[model samples]
Target: MSIATSVPHPAVETARRFARSSRTHDGLRCPNAAFDAWFARQRLVNRFEVTPVPFSRLRGWRFRSDTGDLVHDSGGFFRIEGLHVTGDLGEWSQPVINQREIGILGILVKEFDGVPHLLMQAKMEPGNINTVQLSPTVQATRSNHTGVHGGRAVPYLEYFTDGSRSRTIVDVPQSEQGSWFLRKRNRNMLVEVVEDVPDHPDFRWLTLGQVNRLLRRDNVVNMDARSVLSCIPCLPDEPAGGAYGRALHEALRPGSWSLRSDAEVLHWISDLKSRRELTQQRIPLSDAAPWRRGPAAITHPTGRYFRVLAAEIAAANREVPGWTQPLLEPAGRGVVAFLTRRINGVLHILLNARSEAGCMDVLELAPTVQYQPCNHPGRPPRFSRAAEDPARLVYDTLQSEEGGRFMYAESHYRIAEVDDACPLDVPEDFTWVTPRQVMDLLRHGYYLNMQARSLFAALLALA
Candidate 1:
């Protein structure tokens, strides 16, 4: 839990050089001009003429042929689906376009002179306005990693699977594409190289401090990188009177923020579970009626939760950003937050058992709040009624979501401290658990969704 005092990394200058020479666009820098041009050339055209079809007849999505019978790959990897999710908080009248893939998102770490440095990539995505941003060392779909697409294999894949030499810092399945994706998860991992490894031009080694500075900006770090970074544990050393220190103060004294105790919070959760209910049912896309059909996309009659649109993208920096593809767009910005309280000197987070139509399991533990602005019901009555000072925050930052693929991807991540003396009321759908306990549950797969995992990474960075 402690990082020893150390000097600046030797590669700090190298990282700076990479950042400076990169092409700047809307504050996001793309280090590779070819990649930028490649992305710019992409031609995104919405095909509003195509007729809507059944989920089983989803075009372009591949199905498995088991014993000569075409079947959905339920256990293979990820699948595409049409989801209609409605709850007391919000209702989506339209069928949501979703991707339920479990990809791999990993970070490579190495220590020099007792200092830890991370290897990041300046990768390009089709939906990114800036073209390229700092990404994880290894970000690839199951097909890419498995060479199904006949592309170069993901680098450092062995670091995660090879156990003899690599030391695992964090390895867990974190959710992605939360707003539109039906429980799309990724295997997020951070591993320390035990021996010397080759480096790539697209990747740069950066200190945690350097990464933190970049994270404060908009669309500078991709979602895959942010999710991986959020899992990092607290450092051994941190500057005094910083945001992390302030957040700790707020968490320790609910009185400072006019917040209730652990007991009161539990009671509120109980009330929420008792009143609100989420009901979901699977139906064929063709039968999902009242949806207006367009040549390019399928949309709800009201356009509330999301819409499926086709675009032809031609990016200057993308290897092949010039193709037409279908994408999902949400109605508003999302929020992912954690409510933390110190239990006998250890911080324990309160998590909710949330479920999505595409999730493999019935329910998985999620953050205190993971919903879009339109979907969120606002602060609970008890929390809204409580008095609070703004100064007692441990971590509060508005971070952008995935930019390249998701339309209007932005979210706020915050951690607030409350008094522990309030009533210990509990809710059937919610429980309080420590970070360590959550980490342990992560090994079970599908326990912690992507947003919760990202907050965990942010907590580590801020701490």
Candidate 2:
């Protein structure tokens, strides 16, 4: 880690104080009143209202047919198409058309005090309760990120494209898969900058440790930041910083889980696949039992889970915030967790064999838990219980940042560890794997979900 000349940062002391209180080993709690007060002063107010627009009237975009399929474009940037697929829960005749969306999410880091600090923004999206959240340095769509619409410049975009003065930690530019809802994919990156960079009021430089600390609090780090952080790659030979950093490095290092032969892991996967697998059912939106078409969007009959709504955004912060688009809004918070345990002195993460309607493949490895609490209040949760209970060794829990692109999408993320006593006779749908094994799976695509990848990236940053 390296940096340019240091400037006096007023938030550093506050960041350190909060970091000390929110240690991973000690578990997490809300920050003190002073920090809360300071945090409250930072806000992003929406100056424009989002009004629903007809699909035919959408400017700079159009719907076209391709090989009997429908695709959409905004004149420039990536395109969206509907994919017909059925999940394990669906019958052969029922297929859901999942919207395929693609975008970019990147982060810029600089070293401070021999430790890496991330450059984050106090950005706002239409669906946030807090109005603003700590987001990635650069989170934009292909259109905005590429300046196709001729909007304001995205901050720190040059470091990613110019190929100058940076260390690329996570360069996974990939797509996402989770068919129950919105289908999205992004180009994710995490880089360390070594040159001088100007600071802005909306921008703050916080150590990776500090960022993880803030993550414990509600609505702090945004989804884009989490997703990008999860992509960070941890090389076995990389030098970790001070004692604290080394401890983080060691936590992610191979426990007994890594010593297992590849054949054993494959066998485990095989056994799990045969015994337990996720199943889903897809039907026409019109025939969906729980959903209804409202005047402006498709929503749950009870107004729960998620709803699709259109908005007309107007903002000086965006090149064309004054545009209309459709977004998804959730009824309440969602959860994304990674369950871990030490097997033979090696750390093993618990991954779920999840099936999404939009996934190219039928199943992929997901975090231990990724669910909308309001959508399934009666069902017994997955590893969510362990992730929420600090006594269960699940200290990595934190509320998700708002998905600015989404109407109102947010989730909490956690990484919890279970002891042998927790139960070796777990459900067949789950498997314990080493961090390295998971990273290898990442390269193959669709094996790991974006939420899971974000947590892994955060773990790598700790080193």
Candidate 3:
């Protein structure tokens, strides 16, 4: 990978703007944000059996149909007991939240007083790259969904089959809320909760290893269970601790989260992941030979190179002070980025000019690295031949990943111990795109906003 896409705050803002104009379902004519708004409108009251649940929680629960043939929300707000909502695709803002294995609404609940109650909601645990549904809520609008609540009401975990072998719990729970009741969808399903374990290291809640033992006959790596156990505060009245506790608390964040869209957050996350992966794929324009031509390339060589580039940039900053001042904040928040490389055990720089000023400074990147090169295109180069000089370099500017086809032969950069600071490398001139586009992909997956696709096109245009 060539570049590490820094946080894409701009892209994220663009995504939020696009999300506002989204619709729920086309035929249904629901705004894409309708469910989030609707769920947001409903608040979770304390100690309530059948009160409204925020849509965030309502989207994931498990339930069974009662005699009244209605849905009941037993665990939080997601599970509906009787009624069945239509297609599993109405909400596309978050794919993991909307795509329930059973259907859009996971199970059905029996209706009472013309309204449905909730059971357990099928929820996907966080930290998973993929969605692992536990319980789901059944929608009762009766659009076109066929659900599993008509027959015997079984634990929501039963719906999951490994496709290889059926997993069984050794011990069983006699009651509905028993640990063994719901089908567990992980390495270890909780068989039973252990008791009397002394609260040694400030043990306020159940431990993950205990949950793993209960669920797995053999030693199991219960990732989610460990996460949950860690989050359960030592006393519910006290603060959470330990590694697991810290991680889980951060993920859950206490209350529900609903926004016009997740475009911004996703954009930033995706940018970080994608660019990090391709770190070694970029050009190291900075460590190249100083410029004689192409006055705007990033490969200017030498201190004079930096001075000239910096001066030009500072001069530009004097014009549009607001837009350009961020360039020289003593930090590398410059609009133009670089792709660095390590060649023959030496580091080199490749500059990328994202905007107009960038286009100017980048040209000086190569030739400016070192002072004397008399316009020679070939020879042993400068730094490498300077025996016993660690601070010196050789800047034989190469246009390709393979420098054999040299662009500038003299004063080209080949710095010693350069790779230590520059772990990954990239070709210098390639247009850089932030990875946060994945969230745009998510929004586009639902087709709620056209800008999602348009934004992708704009990013692609950089290529």
Q: What ranking of all candidate models by lDDT puts the best one first? A: 2, 1, 3
Question: Candidate 2, residues 9-116: lDDT per residue as tens digits?
Answer: 122343233233223222122223433454566663435455555554456544344232112344554333333344345532211334334555778866554445
What is the C-alpha lDDT profile of model 3 across 81-109, one tens digit per residue? Answer: 11111221121110001111221222212
Model 1, 1-463: lDDT tens per residue?
1111121122234323222311111222222354334323432221112222343444334323322111233333333244465665365533543444567788887765445677777776655545466789888766557764343567777787678767776777766644455556678887888588786656666666667656655566777897776555432322225544544433322122213343444354446545656656544455456665465556666665666555555444333324344556666666667777665555667677666544444455677767765744564323322212254356666666665445555676777666675334546566776554443344445656777776776654444
Model 3 misplaced regions, further than 4 Å: 1-102, 105-147, 150-433, 440-463
In angstroms, give how far residue 330 of model 3 lies from its true place: 44
Q: How far is candidate 1 from the true structure (C-alpha RMSD, Å)?
A: 9.1
Task: Mark the 10 consecutive residues where model 2 has the least summed lDDT.
Answer: 1-10
TM-score of candidate 2 on Cα atoms, chains taken together: 0.72
Off by over 4 Å in 2: 1-41, 44-83, 92-102, 112-114, 164-167, 180-183, 234-251, 254-259, 266-292, 300-304, 381-390, 396-398, 439-445, 457-463
lDDT value for model 3: 0.20
